[model samples]
Target: MRLTLASYGLLTGIVLVVVVPFLVAVSYRAEQRQPDLSPERIIAASQGAFAPAIPPAEDLAVLELAAEQGIALAQNNLAVILLRTRDSRNHDRADRLLEAAAAQGLVQARYNIAYRIPYRFNTDPALVERQIDLLQRNVAADDIHSMALLAARLGFENRERFVEDRQAEQLALLQNAAATGDPDYLFLHGAELVDRVRNMPPSDHSPARLVVMELALEAFLASFEQGEPRAAQRISAMIAERNVGALTDRLAAMGLPTSDLEWLDMAGQAGLAYADCHYARKVLGDLWPDDLMTEPLYRISAGIVQDALTHPPERRQRALDLAEACATPPQIPEFRPRAFGHTALYLAKHRGGWPAIGDSRGQADVMLGVIAALGVFGPVDREKAAFHFDRAVRVHDYRGGVGFLDRLD
Candidate 1:
């Protein structure tokens, strides 16, 4: 049994050659394999919750791995991320992932793929038709997102016949999704309700039509409550319509409680330009007090006049010229002194004023006259300013102010 040194060395060399490679291969494989690849683990890691002692993988890499392992959610999520890149290669991969996920009966994946191929851009009619078919299936399954998307795209793909089919189907889809409490859906639903009312037969006296109109109003109110700015404007328009048209009696008969003023206040608070401007006009309208000296408008005008008086003559004249330009009605609406003055005039012209100056421009003329007489924007011109005030007193029946004749002329 004695072995020679050469034979022993040859046996050791053979063992090293085989065993070392096998050990190295096993270590490499172990390093490459993940400790956990479950859907939860994949999602957690993607969201930055890493397992202890495991090397962190990029979110996309983890999702890709889980997707390849046939996790439908991972596939759908990965495809969503890929689709956002807008790269053609990524889009192709995303399409395949979406297809795979959809085939596994994921409702969102079906909608995602259908939404991805917008018929507007996709020239392939067959492909567009397929997407429509998929969307219709999802809609039938009561997928709210699919209903909204299909409602939008239904007529966009096909001919006039498809467009004609939109009225009932689109309205139904919008109405169904409206209760989902999504602001956009509520707005669309309100708009559809309005359209239905507009198309009602004129001679039809169905209480149901009034109910539908009331529903339209309700939808707009709900949308505004949900913080949609456009809804505020619509409500304002409705209020105006009620005030101007004979529909006021009709709508009021329905006991439709309109929050016209309340909605205007909210719209003003939310910084809507038109509503805010209207609010400013309302405030200014109430500003005609017994003592003009106590008014904020009077004080602001006095300060400007004081500032101009302190300047040297030439500089005062230049500043006065600029101030005069500023005093004119601004091309753009805003809440400034000029705006207050202009709005006073606008209200006096379009809406009747206090009973003393009823249906006349007297109140506005007096404001303008006083502004000019005090040199709020230019040199004090008693003669020029008195013209408007005196004319209002004589012609327009304005006796609110004593003409400030001594102060003016």
Candidate 2:
């Protein structure tokens, strides 16, 4: 009996000594073959290298692993990849991933989720509320983009039905965002102030409001200096309408550039279509260079004017007529679809006269379609509007879709 028990014990000891060591060796080798990815390397690749193409199978495995391990940036980047790839199922997963990152207080993740809600979530009431909540949270956390978006949305008069004291809160948020020195925020804040002044009754325009308007103009100038082209148009319009001397003095006091010509020159050089038109009309005395086109509309307008200049003296009147038609307003009207439609129709008739100027042609198409659909200048041609709108949307201009929706309601 003792001999039999010893034999069994010896067999157990042999198995432990041999099999256990073999298993441990295999485990160690597996770990050595696949080291954990470093956070820095993953982040860099996700931002640039992995963005242009699909990642290798092994790299995707590593990224998934990192995301599952609660790495917020990894989750956010993976979400971006899924969104780009764009399978319906993957998009839903991407939303979950964005939510996970937002849970970790990632402002960008929150912003992206809010931005996608209308398009991806079909403006679901629940999703819209979630977006508002996310924006509010980010605003409280002092996220600059969040502040700008929230303020802009709230500042619209339509928002008053939803949020109490929307205007005051919107103004405060704009001011907060402007303090960050971001060019976009500066322009938005300045625009909001301008709207406020424009909407107020003349009798109610106090010295305080005028002071705010001056500050807003200064903000616009600052934005222009920071490379915001829209600011140039704003400054040009204000100078053209208001007391230029007083406005210049106010701008100088605020350490902003006071010269309208300098501002126009800068904006024209920066490739703003409106600024180019203004500079050509004011400084060049309607004499546009043959190669002065930057935007498609500019190309059409400038091409017509240039073509007219080449006409014979006897037919110079025809050139002058076309040039007059090509003239853009000194102050761009906010909602002058009639004028825009006229220009658009003229451009459409002479489409072959201008050199093609890339995506600006697409923008012009969209604008013309919207104006025509709204019947702003002439009888509404829904069929023609649908054609242009479809073309614009095919090129990924969702604003065309918005115009369609606006007309629907």
Candidate 3:
């Protein structure tokens, strides 16, 4: 019996020495094999947030693993990706993820949820209340995004039907957001101030109107200087209507663009496509130039484009000849389309004079057809355009559509 007990003790000792160390080593190796889910690592893997492009499969896998591991930021960003997909099932998952993130104190998730609510003067009472509540909470936390969003919601329209002091609240929020000197918020604040002055009674003769106008002008100028090109358009419009006295002098004094054309040019260079289009029309007319084309040929082609309708048959044919002579590879890619479109318009109108102008018109139509068919100009009809836009949206091309697509209708 003594020898058996001693044998058991010796076996127990051997088991502890071998099994415990084996278990410890296995645990250490398992931990070492686990991928890092640190904030920096997850953020680096996150994609499809600010960009139009979808994240690659590898990135999605990394994000999925991190999100599954309970990373709130990863969940929020993945929610954004799902929401952008616009699939109904994906939207449900996105909402759940956003709620989870918001529960974890992610303010951006709350702001995003509130931003999706449609504001129609409190037409939907439940949604309005929910949005207001969410935004108010976020605003209390001093979130600039929430402040701007809440301001927009409250000040949208029909304030009298809602809270009596909603306007004051909205203004306060705008002022707070604009105080941060963000160009977008500054522009919004300026627009709101302009609305205030417009709504005031004319006979009131309140010095407040002048003060508000001045403040708005300052906001617009600051916003424009900070890379908000639309603010320049606002200032130019105000100047054109003589809405603000001595606006041109003030602009000149500040070494800013004083003339309408000057403002348009500045805005154009700042990447406002509308301003660019208008400025190009004002400077170059409807005509577009080919690469390495001489200034004389450009001017003549522009004249032909503008005066094609009034020109005699012989002169029209001569103008077509000049245009053909001016044709070469397109220098300005943007102008290529307009050149083709305008040339086609001229050809269509001059069909009675030159029936054999097929080659010139055919080239233009070929280019225009390619552009139109590829959905650059949206669609050949409204129905197709809507479908194209809808598909583009579903594929996460909303921003790209707005930025790159032009609607013919």
Candidate 4:
């Protein structure tokens, strides 16, 4: 059966209409299953941990295809996946891809490279300027989102330079965002306003300043309560530094079952971040009862004071349990090798700086756990708790800039 020209034409049309769309659909489904190198992925990764909406294997296939197409954004995306994924298999290739995109003047690529540069990439002012410039190119294109970021970086750099006019510039960017109803802009702007009120000289304090302070506090509260952990942490730090009493009252008003002053462990294996806050001791002390603690047990938990009669004991057992359970650092999850590596960090800080617990590690849960374990199992040595505390202080500074990220001032 010899096919005629009409039959060939009909087949070609069929391939274009049916086959092409099918291939495209399959490719799209695959891409959707991986990080699409999209804005959402970038935001999620930068704001929190990298949670690939897609599986890493599937993401790799999509990234590989994007790389093959010579897409600049795709290359950058693939590089980020590779960098974060630590695909040793793709390390060299990912480096090349990033370099290629950076060569093409991709702003995100430049930012990524700048971030990855040695010494926090804060060394050369010129490098930072170049980064700002690349990022600004998009801002000038009316990328409103980029404008907010540019404003933030400019605020930081300008502060270093003592640029007098930056206050207006920062406000202007934020105002634009607010006018457009951008939640991201609101978070940053609200924080800035609060900072302005907080850092003002006492001489400048007035009724108007008080009003502004209230507004700033409200804005921060609004943003924080909406599940913005970074925002909440920032506001909490601000409140912690200033009025722990007031903040605790505010937390109480938020209707938490426990009082605001209590040391509620933040969820997960982060050993003592919750208790380290100033309000923790007071809150924990105010509510916990005394009698149930065994003498030896009573003596061990330093900050602990148990008395059922004097306090609303039943209401605060949850808080006490945290201290009891945290006698050791609980494992978080797979974020480990990093977890124990930081054992050195807690110990070092426990030594030269503020002890993660006290000047001695006896106050630290992990240290306490070690002491308790030794007493029970290994050697029943005297001052073993003190020894753990000392060892914690002597441990290497493993926690590299843990609290510094959201510590924007």
TM-score of predicted structure 2: 0.60
Worst 10 residues of 2 by lDDT: 343-352
lDDT of 4 by residue, 1-409 (tens): 3578889999999999999999999999998776565544433333211453333565566556666767666677666555545558766776687678777866556545544433232456776565566545755666455456556666554334533576777777666654554444556777777777767886684677656655555554555445433344444455545434544565568764223232223311223344433222333442111211222432433334332223465534443344444333445454411100110010000000111443211233333333343343246444544443444344522222122112221
**lDDT tens readout by residue for model 2, 1-409:** 9999999999999989998899999999999987466776565446432334566766677668878988777777667666656379988987898889889987767776876755332345565567677889888887777777676555335555556788898888888988988777788888879888888786674777778778888788778778887777677667666534778777678786676655655665665654544443443133122222222444443544454355444444422222222232234444311100110010000000111233443444444454356453358777766766676556534342334524344
Q: Assess candidate 1 and give its lDDT.
A: 0.58
TM-score of each: 0.52, 0.60, 0.64, 0.52
**Would you list the rank order by lDDT, best first?**
3, 2, 1, 4
lDDT for each residue of candidate 1 in 1-409, tens digit (9 for 90 to 100) = 3568889988989889998899999999998885566666655544321212222456667787878988877777666655544379987997898889889977777777776665574457776777777778888898766777777666453523433566678888888888887766777777667667767877766777767766777777687777876566566556655322334454467664344544555664554544543432332232152545444555746654555465456644433333233223335443211100110010000010111213224554555466667666568777766775676577556654453645333
Candidate 3 lDDT, tens digit per residue, 1-409?
9999999999999989998899999999999988877776666666334445667877787778877877777777777776656479988987887778778877777776776667685458778878888888888899776788788778556644556688898889989999999888888888888888878886655777878887998998999889988788767666765445566777788887776756765665676545544433343234232311333433443453455445445544433333322222224342111100110010000000101222232232222222333433244343443443344344322222231223232
Q: Which stretches of candidate 1 lie over 4 Å from their true place?
A: 1-35, 45-57, 119-124, 155-165, 201-206, 242-265, 268-409
